[model samples]
Target chain A: MRAIVIQAPHDIRVREVPDPTIQQPTDVVLRVLRSCVCGSDLWAYRGESARRPGQRIGHEFLGIVEEAGHEVNGFAPGDLVVVPFRWSDGTCAYCAEGLTTSCPQGGFWGSVGSDGGQGEAVRVPFADGTLVKLPSAAATDDRLLTALLALSDVLGTGHHAAVGAGVRPGSTVAVVGDGAVGLCGVMAAKRLGAGRIIALGRHSARTDIARTFGATDVVAERGDAALAAVRELTRGEGAHCVIEAVGTEQSMRTAIGVVRDGGAIGYVGVPHGSGTGLDLDAMFDRNITLRGGVAPVRAYIPELLPDVLDGTIDPSPVFDLTVGLDGVADGYKAMDERTALKVLIKP
Target chain B: MRAIVIQAPHDIRVREVPDPTIQQPTDVVLRVLRSCVCGSDLWAYRGESARRPGQRIGHEFLGIVEEAGHEVNGFAPGDLVVVPFRWSDGTCAYCAEGLTTSCPQGGFWGSVGSDGGQGEAVRVPFADGTLVKLPSAAATDDRLLTALLALSDVLGTGHHAAVGAGVRPGSTVAVVGDGAVGLCGVMAAKRLGAGRIIALGRHSARTDIARTFGATDVVAERGDAALAAVRELTRGEGAHCVIEAVGTEQSMRTAIGVVRDGGAIGYVGVPHGSGTGLDLDAMFDRNITLRGGVAPVRAYIPELLPDVLDGTIDPSPVFDLTVGLDGVADGYKAMDERTALKVLIKP
Candidate 1:
């Protein structure tokens, strides 16, 4: 089986790896149809995150069930499904609460001792719990397939940011990034009926997508200028909700600055490095509601799948570049060089 | 007129001061009837917060409106009122949104250039906005006076904590302090119909009052042990809500530790000192909702006053020590020595 592996910093390769086997009754084999390069992957690709030599990398994919374990139910071989970034036991208390990301028995794809998603095949644990089955019609719908694949991670994460920030009808939302997730956040806010959607980004191409994704305003500014622009747009009261999609100290600070009193910040950036601290005094005095973490993609996939299937939304545009399994390195390069919004890989 | 003044660290005195008079069209002179030592007062009393020599101290008080300015409405001389710790213009966007503590035109009492509450007479700005009028029956009711006084800060703050944490009829709440505000939080949780209340504190007297205030359980532990006890009590799922009343890193961490996935933490403690950073990675991964800040006492006073007046809750027990204006120094000393759970000063 050909799989994406990181041989070293900036060294992405596609190499033959042993095929995954069903080792447990709750496990099933998946024939990955699509995988993608994530902004988060840049952490390890750029040697910013710790990784062993030749480590399997990637955590988002859509596939067909090649084989099912004996205990798996409601799903079988030949079924198309969307795989969440994390696998969880559906019965855990956290999972029951729709926080499958925090499930006690949850495991992340490509994490230590776990299977990776960017491969020809994957051994999915808790198969029934982690895979959202797609209808047979999905097999022939290429456009819906791209949108469905997004439910595996980026789109679901953007939705989490919006929901966590309490975006609702008439809400004024500020998305503090223009990456694929940020653009999706703008789309999510618009879908949730936000009255005003502001996207803060520096790049022209990304901001253009942000506008297309329903951003009512785009500020190609940084630091105090961005904060001032949001405040001025919001009548100096700040936005009702701020979605922080960029995981950086500066981005979080900006989000905090542009949120109104009694408003909230839904941050979905995976924090990296140190000196990233919250201004507790400011957060407290402003009465800000800070809520966000990892997205429970599996929990949200079921709810979002119908919207995609019905063509209410098409997040497929986020994938600006596509390649074959052997071109995984080029996919990483396109994203790293800021030439591609996101890259999709075909197996 | 005589007033409580801070001459130096640990040095509190009753010194002769000029009589207060209505100074602005929106100002009114308040004849303070009752003031108290707050946990936050310790910060200034212990030299932790910057204070000028002979600075007016204290911010919580119940008073009689001695005189009303021409612009003041809904209040007049002889009317009893409860003054929130911070004064706010009722018409500000934040104030109108029920976030009075974050009002753009708000100012904290006892702060530089502001009138302090612990005095024989004090000029109050935004009298119509900051003062919650009490019924004539409160004048002769000493019992109700004590309960009403709590509404100025501790009780309202506790209510904010509970409400911030989303405590409801079936919620299991864990309060992380045993001071006045913490005890009030326990009481607020009970009033809000929390099914179970766990209090974390080390003092026997405070914990005893905690039980009396409606804590279902008390853990005289800190750090990991405290978290373990709460998790054990909740059958390993942790509480549905956690109220962090002590603004320390350890307390915040414990509150986060004992909160169930998808649960919330309502913190009200004035974050003092540094090195208090959030575990963003942990908070993000766990999907915890961290919402809190300075309590909007004015927003809650109207809702809670009826419960206190009708004897539904007796928060007066929290004021275990009482003193006259002349005994102001002793009041501070008793609280500083931890010999009194709370000090009530009759001016």
Candidate 2:
């Protein structure tokens, strides 16, 4: 089978790799129907995050179960499902409390835990907890699979940001990124009844798609100009909720500054790779609520899958391009080069 | 009329000043039945905050309405009333929003644009908004009057802290600072139905008082130790709500450290005179909600006054010492020296 491998910084290759087999009693082998490189993947690709040889990377995917281990009872071979990025036991105290990302027994698929998901075959542990079965569709239904693939990670992440920000009906929300995930955040804000959705994006194409995803306004101006624009629209009080989808010093500050006093600030962007500081002096006076670290993706996938099935929220607008395993290297390149909103990969 | 005047820092003198008279249609002249020195008063007495020559220096008082301006009909002559340290015009936008301290047209008494409350007689402007007329028995009840004197500031400030923190039934509250305000916070938490109240204080007397006011446990600990104590009681999740009463770096950090993930923090300690910083990095991961600055004490007095009237909560325990008008200097010295929890000045 073929897989996209990071050869080094700025060097990615689509190369042959052995297919995965179920390794644990609870594990299920997924024949990848669709997968995508996340925004975090670009960090290592751009040399910001350390890259190493023989390391498998991507974590977002939807697939047909090729095999299920003995202990996995809820899923069976050939079942269509969305595989959330994190594999969890689902019985840990943290997961029980809806903080799946912090679950002591749960671990991320691609990061310091098990194998990555961007391949022809990937083994998912604790299938009952991590995989959400979708209604079976024909193999030719690429669009539905691609959209469901989004719910596995980015869409769930966007909803996490919206929920953490405590967005409500007739509430104003500001989303601070133009990436596919941020576009999904716009969609999530819309689904959650946010009155005004402001997408802070520099790219014209991305902003247009963001509007389709429920962004009511576009803030092309970066940093202070963008925050001032948001505040101006909000009668100088700023938005009721702001999503920090870009994890940078500037973006974090914008998230804090653009939220109204007593408002909520939710961030889904990985602050791990970015050098950002939480200036409490700035946040304290405004009395803002700061929440969200990593998206508890698994917790959301179950609740959001129905919305996707019912056409309540189309998470597919994010898939700007599609590629095969052989084209996955170019997919990463296109996203890193800012030419694609997101590139869906089929194995 | 004899009054306490801070002619300069370290130079408080009980001197004969002109008798206060009603000067505005909404003003009322109060014959000061009781007054007290506050911890904030020491900021000027110790040369921390700016102090001007011949300026009267107290803001906490309970007195009888000796005379009322023609427009002041809510309280008749001889009606006993307790004052809110902050005098708001009641009709201002900020006042309507329940942020009387941030009232656009009102100013802090003794600082600028307002008269002082610490003397034999006081000319209280916006008397209708500032005065809380207790039920008739308060005129002869010394303890209730002294506690009502507390309602002018500390008691009101405590209610502000608890309400701002959103304390309710089953809320696990941690009260930082064991002063009169801190003790009042403990009582307010009980009144608000906090299942557990942890009082962080250094003094034995104050801790005992805290216990009396429904503090389930006392942390004779500061900062890290205090947070540890609070966590031990909370099954390692710290507190559901935190009230920050001390305006210092250490106390502020303690407040942040002692709250659970997604818990709320309310601060109202005048912000260490200038400002203070928060632990944004840890707070982001914890998903904490931070609220409070200068409390709108006026907005809270209306609801709290009745509780004091019916003796549902005894705010009187805060006054550990009492003195006559001539002993006002002694009152200031006792509070400054930490010899009294609070010193009630009788004029």
Candidate 3:
């Protein structure tokens, strides 16, 4: 099997590797159908995070079940499934709490076991918990397929940001990013019944896509202008909910400053270089509610999956580029430089 | 008329000042029956806050109407009243949102006015909004004096913490700090039907008072030990609500760290100095709901005043010392060094 391996900072190469096999009672082997490079993956690819030689990469994918361990009863050969980024035992206290990403017995899909979704074939752990079955009719539906594949990551994350930020019906929400995740957040806010959605994006193309995703308004401005515009749109009350999808301090402050007196700020941007630190006394005085982390994707996939299959929500418009596995390097470079909102990879 | 004035730090003098006359149509003059030194007032005396020159001190008071201006129509001469610590116009959007403390025209007594309640006479601005008319019997009952006086600030603040922190029937609450405000929080939590109230205090006397106010367990521990004790009591799930009454970084962190996931932190402490600037990313990951601000005392006074009159909840224990207007210096000294929980002054 051929796989992409990151040897060290700024060094990634495709090489032949041994195929993965089911190792645990809950394990199932997946022959990769489609995969994509994630924003987090770039952290290591760009030398922002350390990566060892020959390590398997990627946590997003949709695929066919190549084989199932004897104990894995629900899944069988040739079954279509979308695998979330994290694998967890569904019965653990944390998993039961809807925080499957932080389950004690769970681990990141790409880091712990045989392989990651970015490769030819990867072994999924706790298959019953990590894999969401796609209906046969929508299995080959490219638009639905892409959206379902995204449910493994960005789409679920966008929904988490909206819900955690307390976006509600009639709420005015300000989304603070232009990436695929931010685009999906506009959809999530719409699904949650937010009356008005403001998407802040610098790029014209991304701004247009945000509009298509249900953003009622788009602020091409950044920093104080963006904050001012949101406040103005809200009749100086600021937004009822603000979503931060960029991990910079400026973005965090923008999220905080643009929320109304008792509003919520939901942030999911993995801190790039520095982290998010807030003024305790100020937050205390402002009465703001902040909530968001790695998405509890598995918990929402059951409900979100049907919507994706039936075309109630199409989250894949954010994926502006698609290519064969051989062009994975170009996909990474395009995303790293902001040339593409997202890159979809096919086997 | 006699008034309590802080000539400087550590020097509070009761002296004759010009009798207060309404400067605005919304103002009303009151013949003060009683007033109490506040924990916050000690901040100026101890030089903890920026102090004004010859500042008129004292905020809590129960008094009688002496005169009313043209615009003040709610009461006539001789009606008893409980004046909130802050005066609000009542007609602003902020007030309509139930945030009277943050009302655009609202301001706390003693911080600016020269005739705050620790005097023979005082003037209340926006009297119609800040002054509530009770059945004269409930307002003048010496039996309900302390609790009614408490409704002006500390007791209402405690209720603010309980409601903001989301304590409910069968919920567990942890109160950090055992000052008068914190003790009142214990009482408020109990009234809100919290199943367990853990009061963290170092002083045995303070802890005893906390238990009397309905603390099921008194963790004489500060910092880490208090958090451990709270977690232990909640079967390792942590408290459902944490009321942070100490306005320091350590207390704020403890408040955020000790609550169970999805629990809330209601903080009311006016920030003493600089703080650790809360970690937004860490808090986002923890899934905690943080809500707090200055107490909207006027909003709670009506509900609490009746309880005080009926002798259902007693907050008078907070007024541990009594002083005549001439003894204002001693009141400051006693409260500053923790010699007294609160000092009441009879003009």
The TM-score each candidate achieves on chain A is: 0.97, 0.95, 0.96
B184, model 2: CA deviation in Å? 3.1
lDDT of 1 at A143: 78
Identify the runs in model 3 with alpha carbons over 4 angstroms from their true place. A15-17, A70-74, A112-115, A271-277, B113-115, B273-277
2 or 3, which is superior by TM-score?
A: 3
lDDT of 1 by residue, B134-241 (tens): 997898899889999999999999999999899999799999888899999999999999999999999999999999999999999888999899999999978889
| All models, RMSD in angstroms | 1.4, 4.0, 2.7
> Which candidate's lDDT is highest?
1
Order the candidates by lDDT, highest first: 1, 3, 2
- Which stretches in model 2 have alpha-carbon errors above 4 Å? A1-23, A42-55, A138-140, A219-228, A247-249, A267-286, A323-339, B1-33, B37-59, B65-79, B92-94, B119-131, B163-166, B221-229, B269-277, B323-338
- DockQ for the candidate 2 complex? 0.26
State every prediction's TM-score relative to the real structure: 0.98, 0.85, 0.92
Best by TM-score: 1
Question: Which sequence of candidate numbers ranks them by TM-score, best first?
Answer: 1, 3, 2
Tens digits of per-residue lDDT, candidate 3, B1-347, equal 88988788788888788999999998899998879888878778877776678778788897889899999889888888888888899898877877787677888777765467788998888898889876677654665766678888899999989987899998899998789999999999999999999988888878898999999998877677777887888888788798988777777777876787666788787776424635555555555666777788898887887777777899988888888987778878888888888888888
Task: Write model 1 residue lDDT over A1-347, tens digit each, in one string.
Answer: 98988899999988899999999998999999888888999999999998888889899999999989899996899999999999998988778878898888889888877778888999999987788889978878887888889999999999999998999999999998788888889988988999999999989888888888899998888999999998999998899899999888888888888998889999888876311646778888888898888899899887888888898878998999999988889889888999898999888
Q: Can you list the residue pairs that collide in candidate 3?
A: none
- Candidate 2's TM-score reads 0.85
